[model samples]
Target chain A: MPIVTVASPKGGAGKSTASIILATELAHAGAEVTILDCDPNRSISIWADRGTLPPRINVRSDVGESEIVKTLKQQDADGRVVIVDLEGVASRLVSRAISQADLVLTPMRATTLDATIGVRALALIEEEEEALGRAIRHAVVFTMTRAIKSKQHTAIEKSLRGQGVDIITPPLMERAAFSALFEFGGDLRTMPVQGKMEPAAENASAFAQAVYNRLVGKGL
Target chain B: MSDKPTFSIDLDSLKTRRKDTTPESQGRVDAAGEQHGFVNREPNRKRGRQPSPRVGQVHAKVMPNVADEIADEAKRRGVQQGVIIEEAWVLYKNR
Candidate 1:
């Protein structure tokens, strides 16, 4: 019944992508999962509307700040693991969710553009720590990092480590299958795949498992 | 064994209330001049009468510093802010 939030202030950080992948994987593993699609764009909402979700997985769309806390508590009370996909900005709602979170997942792409905005998102978590007088558990998942690490990616990783932020390993490599989830309107396990689908699926699963491990403190 | 929580915003009453009240009014004064057939019924008081000592939610405002203090204490005690606030309110009343 952990509440994990996928958040980043920067758009194109793969926040929605990572959220959907992790949620679907957890559901495939038989966990009852509910996704709060808090993004204004309603990415998960649109995806959910496109097809039937796997049993035990539900999507709650258009969750505003007023409704977030009660809705989250209500969802958790029903024995479902709750995942909040936050809007790509630092705001009161983001802080509120972070304060109540069991774990906060911040997605960061391997680029200078994402690095700066990504740091701000992580800082929002720190702000919640100040507000609550406790360390809010959180980590950064480097999204779209190429296997051949660019100089920018290495630099970004080193910078984050200096700030003592934990990064989920096996950085989510860029994959067509991930986007295909949105394009095809289904979970990773159910989507029809082409040549790149196998490795893409593996990456998505490993990324999800890594996130789950971090959430439970089973892995770094 | 459980499903999502539904709303307390009942939409069923719209239809039933219309049905229950419409015939009562129409039965009293029919177009055919039928005026004394049915006993006069009091239009139903608000159905789904809210339980007394009513529990409801409210949005409130306080100083940001005060809110932060409450949140910090809530975390320190591993309690919800609502619970802490409720106890503090009672203690304040006695004080």
Candidate 2:
């Protein structure tokens, strides 16, 4: 049971969306999973209530700093893969969450501003690593980008890589079906979106598999 | 020998006063089998090569109790949580 924490300092960084997609994908893949929605927005929790979640996926909301460690430990101890969706900005909850994260995923769109702010999330992970006296593994994934890699996307990625950041491949493309997921309250697998559904499913699957491999391929 | 690593975390380390909340008066194992405030010290047994500094940065899925055990061992050994994890990871790899 691993704990994956999706974090970014900038808002609308796709933390909630990535959280949903990963938890749902893992559940569909036969892994028992739980998403502890630590975001105040309750995006994942609301989505779970609004739509039929994939089997073996559990979404919980209102998880704050005080209980994050406990919840992470408990859910993980139960053999449930735990995914935590964190709010943007630095806080006690955010720090506490990162301290316990097995993998800290910082999501950002492809843009100069996003790249700049994404550094803050990476810094937060480093700060926690120092505090806990441990290395916190993390990576940056391009979120809400065009399917075709733009020049800007490549430049930003190259810069991050040069700075020694592990960039997870398979960017979550900008798809109407992604928004349709939350709008209609269901997962990308079963969510009905004419024309956009198949590509969106493929994109989500790619991103999910990349993440899962990164988790498994670590320390080998 | 089983390839699976079964590391038992002391329920007592979890019992230790949480960094956030007030220390509890009663010492009881809750339904979750979590014992807060109990500190168990096992001799620091060195295993394999010392982990490189980058071991702290590697990310992967691991058993949940592994993190707890490392956290507890960090406290017991007066080392960083990452150090314990790095050592445990090397041991797991070599196991």
Candidate 3:
């Protein structure tokens, strides 16, 4: 199985949102998926508690760093896709997750601070590659983007590209539906299937699909 | 695979030793022209077999000096040379 780790050092960068969207989308696509929630906030755990996650999307919360590695190894040995929702800070466990991930997705807001914080995460990834003797395919996807006044977004995009970071297409717009997702404890894909309609529901689904395509298409 | 000898052959010392071994060594024109293929000293026999069709036995062009390139970049980046070297090796291995 290929492990996809969603991580970022800056808080409120929508790491959990991206993780949940990708997990729910993949599970809906008939893949055996499991999420290892390493965030102490347990945002994903709360979402799972509210019965938002589908039965196919199995989530294991409060897992330590070593346990996450063992579980990922087991899943890889069994040929299952494992998506890890890492905490929004740099920690040993988060480092281990990035080290083990076949692909690392670092979601960033369009602010300069958020984009700057991604540099630290990228440097950490480089450090992990040095220690582990392997390269993990990573990309930065812009989240909560504003349609107009996108100068900050463009600047961040240019900076990341100059640093040789892959920026995935179809930026996730800042929609009330995304923040509203937490209240219902469900992702975009789950909301539509569960008969709850929102204006940005389809947009969220499309964004999630783009993430899936990039990850799965590269065989990561 | 047979174990390759692990002798540390310093080129600078070898050049100094060559100067002591030969009267005309102080004016050494070129190291490559003199040393390369000098061990198999039959010039006429070697010339005839230079382009021999022995695919596996034929030596390919040597790879560039990757370590030196990495060290230069590491110096410019103000980090350890090993960091650049290791990152390149990891990228190559992963690819």
Candidate 4:
């Protein structure tokens, strides 16, 4: 199993939502997914509590600094996929989780504040690579995007690309159904009708496929 | 939406690789994280002696003189009134 950690030091950067969407989408695609809800906020647990969890997905909540590495190692079995949703701070827990991550997905909104704070995770990854003497795969995903790309969004995308940062394409758009995952516990298919359901599913599916490509060594 | 092709995952294609989980490697990771200001942020536990677990109450009614004497003896001995009660129980049991 590949351990995919959704991390960003910036709060409200869509870490939980991205984790839930990715886990459910991957599970829907026939992969047994276990989400380690490492955030103190327990966003993933709350979503799981609100409704019946979709098939093939399990969530472990309240994972802290002490148990992160051990938990990741224990859950990284042969027949499952592990997705870790981390807290929104630069802490040792994030570092320890990144150390075990097969792929690190830093989800940030198209804003300068998010990029400034989110870049710290990337720096920490680079430093860990140097210390551990291994290349830790990492990428950035733009979240809460709109159809009409703002000038700031374009500039940020360009800057990140220029720095050789792997940015996942078809960035997760701002969708009503995506936000409603917290309200309705299950995946998009099982949840009640929110806004348009078709495009939301498409966006999530595409994003998960992009992540799957990265996990399997297929460049996005 | 029903017309969309089903997306299937090949479980066998997803390979899990081993990472260094040794104490030395973890120490190095911690050091690197500290350089980036990602220090341990777990909340500190409360420091100090915990409260005693003997929480039962006796609420026995006695004569004023006897209660005063018991209180004086406990204060002089620097022990709780429950200690006096325990000693009295031992004496009664022996008798």
Candidate 5:
């Protein structure tokens, strides 16, 4: 079982969206996924409540700093994957969750403010690695991107790469389906058609596969 | 959609590794987080004694001696006067 934590200190950086997309996609691919909604916003819980959660996906909400580690340990088991969605603040809940994560995915939109704040999560991971004496695998995934990359997006990607940061390819585009998950409650397949559903599913599927590849020790 | 190849997960390939959840390791993680301004953000629970849940009112006037005894017993037992009243009611029902 792998615990993938979606964390970012910057608000509106798509941490919740990324968590749902990954969890649902993984569940669709025949993996039992448990999502711990640690965000006070209750984004995942609301989504799970709105509609029938896709089969093989279970959502637990209101996981605070104290219960995070314990809840993660309880939910983790063979043949299951746990996804933790953290609040968009630098809090002990985020740190404690990251400490138990097999992979920490920091979702950042293509903006300077987002990158500046999201990098704090990466720095914390580095420090945690040194303290825990084990390498904590982490990567950055750009969310709410456009079909055409902006100059700022290119610059930030370049800067991060220069710093030897692992950036997940096929960044999640600003798709209507991605946002519609909150309203529809189910995955893209089960939700009503929003915009062009094909590309959205493809993007989410590939992004999840990239993550799965990493989890299985395959790079990129 | 059926024409496209869907992603599939090989369950056997996924492995779970042991993580340190001991207090010492957690303390170190917390320390590192604090250095980066990720301190405890949990909402503070209210301090001091919680409000008593005995909201019901009893208008019965007891004899002076019985009232004094009840007050002294409540104080000695460190419980609200309501507890004594409830026990007395139960005793009446049993009788």
Candidate 6:
């Protein structure tokens, strides 16, 4: 019954990718899910519509930062799992979603600039908790990363740990399969399960599955 | 006197003329099989031990009852609903 939210302040951080991919896997696993697209870009909403996603996956594009809490409260009352895809930056709505989230997954690229902005988002979450007196479950993940760790990646991870922030390992690798996702409007699970596939597609699918497991837990 | 006339129904007079018909209030039994007054105030004597750590199971319990609490919290803290719930949960969970 946890509501997971993907939020970040900077663009190109794989927020949309993470949201769509994880949601797709969960829906495939037979869970009633409602994905609220808070981004004005409407990327996830559009993808769902364009691809005619499975019936189990209900997409709500009308959601915004302002109405998310009440909506989630109502949905929680109805016993539906809520997954929010938040827009970038520290907007009023983004903060509200983070405040309401059972787990706030903030995605950042493996770069100094991304990690720097991530600290700001983490700070905002902490400040909101202090001022509002609500406990918000939160974690950070690095996305669109190369296989090999760079000096910047190690430093950023260490810095975040020093700040006492939770960060998930196994950062998502940068690959064309993820980029191709927006075009086909399909995620890894929806792809051919048996046929031979490109290396990038296989890697993307593995990465997506790994993330899905971490979010929902082992059996899922 | 003017052709137009005005009449008023007297609420005060009506109240004095009605018979009382309320059901008698009943005392509620606590978990320890002890009866207590109808009000929500704490019992006169300590009852059973505190609840188990299962209190965490009801975190979302606050979300549904938020409407009732929001008005009270807003008036007490002079802050917005988002801030009050957020801060309250943090304090509630840590304890």
- Scanning candidate 4 chain A in windows of ten residues, the lowest lDDT window is A71-80
Residue-level error in angstroms, candidate 3, position B85? 69
State in Å the error of residue A203, model 1: 1.1
Against the true structure, candidate 1 reaches a TM-score of 0.67
What are the per-model numbers of colliding residue pairs?
0, 9, 0, 0, 0, 12
TM-score of each candidate structure, all chains considered together: 0.67, 0.68, 0.63, 0.88, 0.89, 0.61
| Span of ten consecutive residues with least summed lDDT in model 6 chain A | A192-201
Q: Chain A TM-score per candidate?
A: 0.94, 0.94, 0.88, 0.98, 0.99, 0.84
Model 5 lDDT tens row, B1-95: 44233788989877788999999999999999999999998989999877669577688799999999999999999998999999999999999
Q: Which 10-residue window of candidate 3 chain B scores lowest in summed lDDT?
A: B12-21
Model 2: CA > 4 A from native: A218-220, B1-95
Residue by residue across B1-95, what tens digits does model 1's lDDT show?
11222111111211110011133322222221211111112234587866558555446688999999989999999997887778987999999
Worst 10 residues of 3 chain A by lDDT: A190-199
Of the true contacts between chains A and B, what fraction does model 3 have?
0.00
Cα lDDT tens digits for candidate 4, B1-95: 54343577889978779999999999999999999999999999889866668666677999999999999999999999889999999999999
Interface RMSD of each: 24.8, 15.7, 28.6, 1.7, 1.5, 28.6
| Model 4 stretches astray by more than 4 angstroms | B3-5, B52-82, B85-95
Model 3 ranges with Cα > 4 A deviation: A77-79, A189-199, A218-220, B1-95
Tens digits of per-residue lDDT for model 2, B39-95? 112224598888677644567566899767777889999998777767777999999
| Model 5: CA > 4 A from native | B3-5, B54-95
